[model samples]
Target: MNLELPLAELTALLLASVRAAAWLVVSPPFNSRTIPSALKALLSVAIALPVVPTLVGKVPQLDTAEMVVSLAEQVVLGAALGFLTSLLFSAVQAAGNLIDLFGGFSVAFAFDPLDASGSTGNGVFGRFYNVTAITLLFATGAHQLVLRGFTMSYKALPLDGAMSLHNLQHLLTNGLVEMFMAALQIAGPLIAVLFCADIGLGLLSRVAPALNAFALGFPVKILLTLGGAGLAMTMLPQAVSTVVDKAVTAVMQAIGS
Candidate 1:
């Protein structure tokens, strides 16, 4: 079968593909190191095809100056969307870090295989949380919600539409704040339990000066934290769902879709 398109149409398609690939390479679930680059590119192209028709007719004709500007705009837009989607993972990781901190695992560090980056204190927990969230994201079909957000972007911010720096900045700021809030909520229970435990340990030390507080408190706190984490695992699915929903909403709103 012969498949061909006019030069102009081809250029538009290529441009859209570039934008999609840029976003997919950085976004969660799609951007994971485990997913092959070839598969990621293929997925990006598949995503761009449905939206290409709507954009081709409206996007300006390819010219040196216009091409440069449009390409830059597309890259920026893709980055913005990718960054927004990544916040959910960041929130999960942050929660894990908080748990580690309050649980007295601050000195335990581990190399995260998924990120290929070093982590400190509760870094291992953070990485585990992120992986769990990503798994849940796929299981719940939240990835489709992310793709839908991308499609809606076309209507909110067309291919040739002007980029609103003010709006983008606002969205980015709001996303960061929300990420922090989500992390705090997920870690709150563990932190509260640990706090009370610490106070009780301090009182015990004051009461019995002969007792070696460091020797006994360490093991007790570790056990309590592990138990607390086990209990908290029940909430992981709900937290993952909420984070994905918030991320999708943020992306859609960022582009004013």
Candidate 2:
């Protein structure tokens, strides 16, 4: 028995795998520490195999210098796309962070062992929202859509060409704005209730100083946040769906599709 592999095809597979691996490192759900690096590497290779045929002809000469450059380009391209997806999806967590801030849960912040970023500042609601969003993302099969968008990105950003930096800049700007806007929309009513609670406490404090209404502010706001959290979460499903579409569009637009 004899086995042989074409150099060009092998090179294409390697380059595609580099891109996929970088993406999985930066993208959410996949980026979680719960997934081992070895598994991610194997998954990257699996993802690359299907696209190898399309890329084989376009694979450049088998020069060491060119190969190094191609690898770097793929890493950068994959990380960019992954970051965009992560940014858009973080809106849900941001909404929860806002709730934590207003509800006095910020003081309960603790280290999250599973977070890739190693940030210790995510409060109770922040962590809760992040977990719920990930659950929804998987349950709704939105992760498949996101993965499909990433795989299709090869069509817009081929292995041989450079991505559009200007387009990436524009998308980054718009993505930030959208993230904040979506977060506020999801958490706005709760925030407003918390704000009004503060105002009422302030008034009571002035009108009846002996009653010490200001002391009740913390507990009252906490109860309001807990109660309104259910209402706010009612919007999360639709918000997640909209965010998936936006993330896919951003990835395509960034690559000039």
User: Which candidate has the top score in lDDT?
Assistant: 2
Candidate 1 Cα errors over 4 Å, as ranges: 1-5, 110-122
Weakest ten-residue segment in model 1 by summed lDDT: 112-121
Whole-model Cα lDDT of every candidate shown, in order: 0.79, 0.89
Best by TM-score: 2
lDDT by residue for model 1 over 121-191, one digit each (tens)? 35556767878888888888988888887767766777787557787788789888988998888889888
My TM-score estimates for the predictions, one after another, are 0.89, 0.94
Candidate 2: C-alpha lDDT: 0.89
lDDT (C-alpha) at residue 255 in model 1: 81
lDDT by residue for model 2 over 31-132, one digit each (tens)?
888899999999899988999988887787789898899999999999999999999999999999999999898767544455545465788888889898
